[model samples]
Target chain A: MPPDTTTVAPQSVAPSGAPASGRPADDLRTLESGLDALQAVPSTEKGSVRRILEGVLPPVLLLAGLVAVWQLYVVIARPRPDLVPGPLDVLGALGTAWADGRLQLAVLTSLERGGVGFLIAVAIGTPLGLLLAEWRPLRLALGPLLSGLQVLPSVAWVPAAIIWFGLSDATVYFVVLMGAVPSIANGLVSGIDQVPPQLRRVGTVLGAGRIQLATLVVLPAALPGYFSGLKQGWAFSWRSLMAAEIIAMGGTIGFGLGSMLQQSRELADLGSVLATILLILGVGILVELAVFAPIERRLLRRRGLTPGGIR
Target chain B: MSAAPAVLPAIRITALGKRFGADGPLVLDDVTLSIQPGEFVCLLGASGCGKSTLLNIIAGLDAPSTGTVTVASGSAAVMFQDAALFPWLTAGRNVELALKLRGVPRDKRRGKALELLDVVNLADAASKRPHELSGGMRQRVALARSLAQDRKVLLMDEPFAALDAITRDLLHEELERVWRETGRTIVFVTHNVREAARLGQRVLLMSSRPGRIANEWRLADDGPRRIESPEVSRLSIEITEQLRREIRRNAA
Candidate 1:
């Protein structure tokens, strides 16, 4: 096709006082600012209070709605206290646990176990993912198997883990690793696969060695996928730890949120059961908010992938 | 340009041929060409002409199926039709990466990258990510990144093909200015006849399906040539006619 050389004059977009190419300095400055203004994103200048409210209000309303529904069900059905617990009953149980410091202790133990398990998963999975991504024969043989493992729920691994490691922390860790490694590895592989060929070409042409290219170019490109994998891995770790704690039935392992849940269920203390479930949910959300969300937001915002970008 | 110091041409290709596989038809065949040092050469051809393939071989990014390409400078940088700037990187950091690869020290890279960005009229945009920049601005950053290589030869495969007409025009002027300033040998592959007429000191028109150089135009005038100039328009027409004839022959 004949290249269209004439479409519209650039003069409209050119900066005011843009020179007609005689003075080099003037022309450059005009072009620079003009280009900037042309591509400028709208200022994300919402008031801080408004921004906070926008972020927090919906979730708060959703929680309130959920509590209202729970309360309504309690009032309507008049379920025995031994069965479904009302929101206030659950809250009272939570407050009692908090006063005794068991709530904090249980949460910390679960979080620590989840954190350690996830770290181990990352340490193992990252290299495995890189290897699978780079080596065709190995990938072809094992890629499908890894993906299959990811789909299999962490609870399924608990029986095997208990048999192998007994009623110890190792059993919990084993289950967590089994649940998480595949996900993290798969994430890395997909990310590596998606690194655009042109970007690699650009890196090669720019004189980056294979190691440098992989580290500087490919790794950064794959960050979104890696971060996603990490998030999923954390979820897996948390789920696996809970399953192990609930099933193992050992007193020495200490009271994690999962152990507390089992104790509440056995005693028919539905209020404590509901409170334990809420605590588990709350901890998961807290970790996501404090650890993962900020990093993800920063990554996306800096790359201009976020809605408003860094504001 | 800089007083032609060396006898060697910037690029030399001899009896070049390319095929996808053993049984595949030849994409390029028996192409021989020489590009002088500090010259602006445009390879102008239609779709399936192997212009990009030829450029790739010269760039050391792809191996030719037959014959050879020898670049005197050894090092060359390429700019693609897409800006292909690392979206994860800021505009300056993209250029800085090129400089860093070339072994520019920690402190020097930032200064050098800023200078290169300035040349592309993007100094103020150094901290902006690729996704934040307009297509034109992204391309200018890509250009700056290419320039950061400090290489004597640049291979561009339709670098401005995706830009709007006005942006392309403005870039053409900026590119011409940079070319004049740097004195680097440039091989720009484009389907645009007017673009070839406007920028290239010499234009090579290639035929497709076993691509070969069919015609050549050397702009003899010493005066500056704009894309809209009568001389450029006349040359563009001449070349377009020749290209049309090549396409028609294929149709027949």
Candidate 2:
């Protein structure tokens, strides 16, 4: 590779006072601007309304179709109401729960636990990830174990958590941490690994010290990977919390969606159980659309990883 | 040129040698050179000629296995083949990072960054991200960031090799303008004969497999030269022939 050099030609007296170079200064500027215009990617983002419609309409239509299918199945086969509830029955059950405020309470309880547990996992995982990333020996010792933890079904931890913490918020949190921490830590490790050697070299050349390089360069570079880790961690946390809530329900633990579903199962009320399942799915979708999607889109757009502003 | 006070050489290398390990083959051997203040010197060589290693030694990124590198200014700023800008940062903020590292206060950093961007004729691109800019434009922003270091010497390692021919030509003009304006000593490493002939005031050719300076050319400061100019082409041909001979010698 040839090194690129920039130089200023010593001013020379050309006939008619024209600069003695490739082109006149004005012409060069025009050429440069023209080049930039031609090569630069144009913004391809659609209007906000269109983007929203595009995002929302398909899922909305799909959900409606799903309900229609369930209703049709009920109308055709005519299954008993208790054995397999129709879509309307599920909706009625959801309405009854909403009317009695049970739905709101269950949602709030589950969401609060999920949020707190995820935050704690992040707090713990971030430093652990950094430590593992920075220390080769430690990573060698523990990296495979961390990855293995991510694949282990978090539900498997519920019985152990219940035995250890005895049917309290501690058990729920313990399960959630076990599920989420490995994912967040793994995300950070991979993110750090992905930071280009060139960028780090650039930081060193710019006079960044060890700490500055890690904080300012390496960490920021690792963000996309770290962010994906957070998304995965949130999923794991929510899933683990639900599992723990269903299995270890008693003493200081208010009714969550998981508990409500378990109660409906015990009563053999298929409608309420179906309603609870829908609510859990809805909350997961809401968080993804409201929080993670927007952040990921912005990250990708800024890095030009998204082509034509479309992911 | 106006008469000026005597100045120390911007860079001096003494018997510099580099090898990967004790038993490894030498990458650079017995390399010695001195560059005057405000000089534009190009290290021209083939792929494995250790020109980049020699540069790394001067930039202090790599230690010499033997001998010494004395840079008068105590610091040098470097640019690479890729712009190597932080992707998360806008072009201006990328430059500002260098200024910030130099301890420029937050209040003053933006203004200084913009000033350097203006030097590279990229002031309008300050807010654009590196990926959003064209290859040529990205390199210009990189130039701005290097300039933001406020160092007396700028080391470039094939900064425009990835650009198109027309863009590379334009950047050559831009770089010449900057070098003249900033009066900074520059050590540019390149494998391209014409690029060396077109840019550097002095061109030093390095031989590969225990790289050593094989020959040198001091191009006369004739009125603005272009890559296509007869003088540059003639010199490039001469240098290319010498470079080929050096390669053949290694084979023999």
State the C-alpha lDDT per candidate: 0.86, 0.88
Q: Candidate 1, what DockQ?
A: 0.45
Off by over 4 Å in 1: A1-25, A28-32, A45-49, A307-311, B1-6
lDDT of 1: 0.86
Docking class of 1: acceptable
Judge candidate 2 against the unseen true structure and give its global Cα lDDT, from 0 to 1.
0.88
Weakest ten-residue segment in model 2 chain A by summed lDDT:
A5-14
As a whole number from 0 to 100, the lDDT of residue A190 in candidate 1 is 89
DockQ of each: 0.45, 0.42
Q: What is the TM-score of chain A alone in each candidate?
A: 0.87, 0.90
Lowest-scoring 10 consecutive residues by lDDT in candidate 2 chain B?
B221-230
Q: Which lDDT tens digits does candidate 2 get at residues A199-287?
A: 99999999999999998999999999999999999999999989988988878888999999998899899999999999999999999
